[model samples]
Target: MEKISYSRVWDLDKVFIGGSKSSQFLEHMNRLVALVNILESSIKSLITPLSINEVIKVVPLIENIATIRLYLSQANSFITCLLAENPRDQEAATLRGKVAQEESRFEKELSKVKKIFTYTKEDVWESMLETEKLQEYRFILNEWRENADKNLSEAEINLISDLMVDGYHAWGHFYNNLVSSINVNIQINGKEENLSVGQAINLRSHHNEEVRKEAHYVLESIWKEKEELFSKIINNIAGFRIQVNNKRGIKSILEDPLKKNRMKEKTLNTMWTVISKYKQPFSSYLERKAEMIDGTGMKAYNFWAPAIKSNRVITFEEAATLITEYFSQFGSELEGFVRKAFYEGWIETEDRPNKSAISFCAGFPLTGESRVFMTFNGTLLNMLTLVHELGHAFHNHAMKSVNGLNKRYPLSIAETASTFSEMIIFDAAMKKANSREEKIFILDEKLKRSVMNFMNIHSRFLFEQRFYKERNEGIVSANRLNQLMEESINEAYAGSLEQPSIYSWVWTPHYYITQSPFYNFPYTFGYLFALGIYAKAKEKGKDFEKDYLKLLRDSGSMSVEELVMKHLGEDITSEEFWEKGMELCVKDAEEFIELTSS
Candidate 1:
């Protein structure tokens, strides 16, 4: 593990003062705001299809944005972490929501400017479709026009976009509240107490049977109280989706996300079909796991419970060493970056109250830096998460040379590098295990993730598919909503589930999330896509690094199929593509089954 000094690693003098907001942060705020406003106005108000004049006007604005974003990196981190530490603080909460809402408005304003210029004029977009140096930029702009026609009209679009704050997306905020403020009815050791959502959930992994069961009950009861609220949230959002979809001439709600994902319907269908075929292998591992734990009917909540290495804890220093040794086999560049992220204070890992209960990476183009934030209490899984976040940072690092416009890959492919890095680490763990129990545990961990990336995500996609379909028809009732949610789980779990899990209540917030669509499948797509690429990298030996970096640079610039073809010599939107991807997962499940049985 990397023994990183908290003070030196993050350069606290630059970002924060005594764990509070820097006194001078607001002084720099106006310039940043002014820069963003100018860029938004200029980009949106292109009067004549963005000719060379318009294009030139954009370069400086884009450069300014890069600068502002870079400056905001640590500042944003400080504010977000501060808010996470105490979400109930009304002032901070309001500020947090306001920033997001204001950003949303700015984006809309930019879109309006685009609409004024384009406004159903095909030539406006097509005119610059072939521009050199920004060919990828032009491709995406034109593609947006093709999609806009099939979207809602201007006034209606404006209304729906605004309504998202109080309507669909508010539900997610509500869910966040429920999770954040949730307090257990019982106390630990007979003391009056409460659990932060992360700590509460983390307790369920305890080896003590009584604690696990108590945590289990606490989770179910709290979620049950808000189930109806969440249910209505789902119904309302689904109902809205249905109405809007039909008006936009959308054949299915899936169409937009598919296009946005840069995939074809045929490819998605093939991918899910192939993924579902591997359920038996998952079942084999699941049954073995259940037997080993002396449990029956391991349900959804049990999904995260530790089957091995109970109550594990380690220092952040140990985690870094394990991360370095594990990643060194892949290539030097990645290993070095992982090392520096710690030694350089690119990671924020001190445990504190109200810090967000999750870990994420933020990329800054101007500084060419990626910062990760999380509390490191030291566990193997914590180490894995460190690697995972590093995966995101490395992904951003590869694209540092590209213009920011070409660096932000679509959501579907965003998980590729992270998942790839994780697999490399997991494989390293597998090789170093000294006992059958360790092998079983390590392999089971991989299998658990497979269930998540495939089965669980597949269920979410199914739910969205039906929710949108029914919504287009009209508003769905609460009872009807529950049925649809169940059906989605039924289809995805297929025979892998020994019994039905009550996580149907847990899915309420996802339906209300308007930030993206077909959210579930992208994770599956990213994992498989990365796996397919990783397979080739293993075969290519040292020669793959140059191509891999080039591929990352191009992810945001090209369509998914186009990017895959350019880098991997195959089209992603084919049955042949997805089939090859799931092959390794099946092999891993088989290996898991053998080890567990032995």
Candidate 2:
């Protein structure tokens, strides 16, 4: 069994000619802008109650725009990769600016078509859907009309899109840059060193309890200094969104995110209702883990505490073999895809300074390719992240033949495949543990994530809901933000911690993104959704593999509820479906408590 080594950087030439600065890349951008102009011109000339002949003429233009947008997506992925590898790359920064401008222009042009579709009477729109050339795009075209109905006017929508570049999105970028610039000076083993925000935060999971506490205080002090700036950033972001929602005739703040997620409000509410009932098991697990660490119960800092240290550094090759081996039990298709991704230079795993500390998989549906970015530190967590990201890549691969428009699934369903892949690796790790200590360590790790995905994420969801509700009135102050966060944590955790991470909202970047409001709950949604699917896999054995792949493939073509019901034969809009997922975590929590106390 020869172990295959993974590459530190992926090949972008597969998607585009040369690199970002290449003449071919420039040509692609120019052509995309030209296509955008043409599309806008063609759409603006169209009249309402569009005849079938007019639709036929317009459909080709829309398809051309979709093709050009695919090229833009490829270029965007390439620029992000370059920037992620070296944040100081001036070339990458320039290209990112250009790409952003073109994307805004392109989106505005696409909105015009949406406006046309909105104005078209239902019979006319349905008649257009029946056309042979337009039938493939029925899902996308229909969705645009449904969304457009919520807009003020085509002119206003375009104005907002243009303003968002400097007004809305600029705030998000500023927060990112501001956070990146701050460094915490921490003394590790009596030697003081300045650590980036991410490095300092990771220290909370350090094996030494003292180090974890020191890291917590250092991070808290750093955030405290910027609390005022963070407060303004959040308030303004929320304020901008609220204003937009109000003008769009949306009353509830949740309306935008729920719509974006393609999930019913009742479904989200039902999921939370079930989660509230299952918090005690997680609280008990946290308490026991804290008790094992010390006589004291859970402390705010101890939430990230590690199990007994049997730490061993793994190599990239070993991680690949381990992941591929476990993935094979699901099916050889997944095994083969993981192998191809590694061998074909679709994964970037460089461990370097200034590299982004996050991991994401970008799907290039037009090219039938996907790229994964992550720093591999060879820890168990890193291995889990590898498979987790690979899970996302696999999902993208499943949808290779899906229509370009249909490939864009909501965030709630996006995590389904990744979490499913993680379960595979996690179950394998637990089975392979060589000692009682190792088993406890594995269980603790699993319990810790369950606590995070369920309780911690749930707290953020609650905090954001309250923050938006209050922000609707006016601006929320820094002190009030901390109070809201702590209140959410206290209620969600049920006395699991001595105190909450009061300034947690100050650091989390999700709340700052203008494009994706309420980004926290999707994680919980995906985790629970995957758990339900994973349980089905266990019960049905290998028969579940085809159904799982089919679910992933159809993810983009339909809403989350439709995707779930069509494939799994379950209604996601009910408490019964959500309760099954919640029970799995509670069961894990009970097992964790029993093992640790034994």
Candidate 3:
């Protein structure tokens, strides 16, 4: 019944004194290049032997590498923000090319460092860690040594890294451009209009059933036209990954992601096993949700359809206040970061052309600051996303005390703070709901998140695994990908859906990233993991917030398994721990069913 303007575009002046192509940025780029050259030259003398003096000499080089990476992150973050606002910016794209090229060189230099660690004797390396300064990076140093057995020759690895600039990573950029440039023609209120693919997809959450279904159909049809191109991009990326793994003598495809995620296979298997037990409950949740929306139980297109149309609109200012209020209950630091992000132009929230459809928090480790990008559309989902990214920013903020090497965390635990924030905000909203409709609406939102993490993400995880296995043997056709996606969705959703989301492979972007493979399951892991932490917070009240921040701070310095055990006194390798998180979702599904009962 009322209008709300939620657009608050960010100011990038704080990040760089000048814009992306400013002389300041160009000078920073020159400095980054010079640093890489110096680091490369220093790598020649980093040979292995029983010399404490050589070890000491290598420390500063390691620090320089970290410093170079910090500058690269700032440059890349600024470029990403610029591109998010205008995908067609050639200067930004060129700058991205330059950054990637420089990063490849840096990776080569770092591999040389890894080689030195690989060649060093166990006793010598252990003795080096005895120093307090070096001991601070024990986790990172030990990780490199442990994983060195899987590394190929330095020349081959460096070559692969170089090729990746225009080879593997190029496909990801191509996919981003393709997705941004796409538009679908749809009829809205008896008038035909052209909308971006993202705009069309958002209509899935529209209050009108026909509009939602049409949007889904139009999107599917559009993606079908580009199915061949999408298939090639994904298959090629998989092919590249498999080739590297084979050369490195890696056994299972999951080995790389597991190691990078800092978890044992037992832990991953245990979590997935717990998730499998909830398929039936999710079926019931979806059934009740569908019944509330329409007579039909569940259909693929209507999966995101709204339950109730509420006149409530949350302005960006109100969203910020709500997040700050909720986070302050945990601690002032959490609240302070949110407030600073709003005041310092750390967030870009305007709805404008060529802006990125997704939301992400980009952390500049060197500066101890993060930039969040999201286009707010005055919806509850948008607010939830704001808190989610802020959660990520908060995680980055907690790591400011640590060195650059230790600030890099595994993807599995990276979602902890974001999901924890989401739970606090959602629960607060539920408590403040003044009517049954409002309660149902909030419940549906919560249930939808569960189903997505449990079902959709599971399907994606399955699809990627199957695709990689098939790709390892031979190239997979577009049709085969569709078949695999369908089978995966059907299995994950327990045949509850009327039809499968067949084109999901084309719709999702995670598969394109070269740095992180098998990125789907981490969402499920983070959702449940954060829910587990949220349970602890509920039990301990404000006291647990201190421990929570501690967990975030130590994420990069320790393994996920060790971090959980040390902080929560829980064993992640056990099924019982994961069951605790599964039960939280199960409780929500059961409550939703009861609320909608006849």
lDDT of each: 0.67, 0.80, 0.83
Candidate 1's residue-wise lDDT over 200-310, tens digit each? Answer: 555544555566567767766776666676666666656666566677787767887888777778778888888877687777667767666766755555665666756
Q: In candidate 2, how many Å is residue 451 off?
A: 1.2
Q: Which ten residues in a row have the lowest lDDT in candidate 3?
A: 1-10
Runs off by more than 4 Å, candidate 3? 1-7, 149-151
The best candidate in terms of lDDT = 3
What tens digits encode model 2's per-residue C-alpha lDDT throughout 1-598?
6645667788878877666567877887788778777777776676665666667676677677777668777778777777665666777778878888888888877777677777787887898889887787787778888887445676788788888877787788678667766667888888987766666766666677888888898888878888999999998888888888887888888888998998898889888888888888888888788888886889888777665664477788889888888888788789899999888999888665465545688877667889888777566767777888899889988877776576678888888899899988778788788977887777877777788887888889999999999998899999999999999998888878775679989888888877799998898889988998888888887678888888887887787888788877899878999888888778878877777777
Per-residue lDDT of model 3, residues 528-598, tens digit only:
88888888888998888778878898999899899988988999999999888888788888887877785
Model 3 TM-score?
0.96
Off by over 4 Å in 1: 1-29, 36-45, 50-79, 116-129, 149-158, 165-169, 185-193, 236-251, 306-311, 344-355, 373-378, 472-483, 498-500, 504-512
TM-score of every candidate: 0.86, 0.94, 0.96
Superior candidate under lDDT, 1 versus 3: 3
Clashes of 3: 0
Better by lDDT, candidate 3 or 2: 3
* Model 2 quality (TM-score): 0.94
Clashes of 1: 14
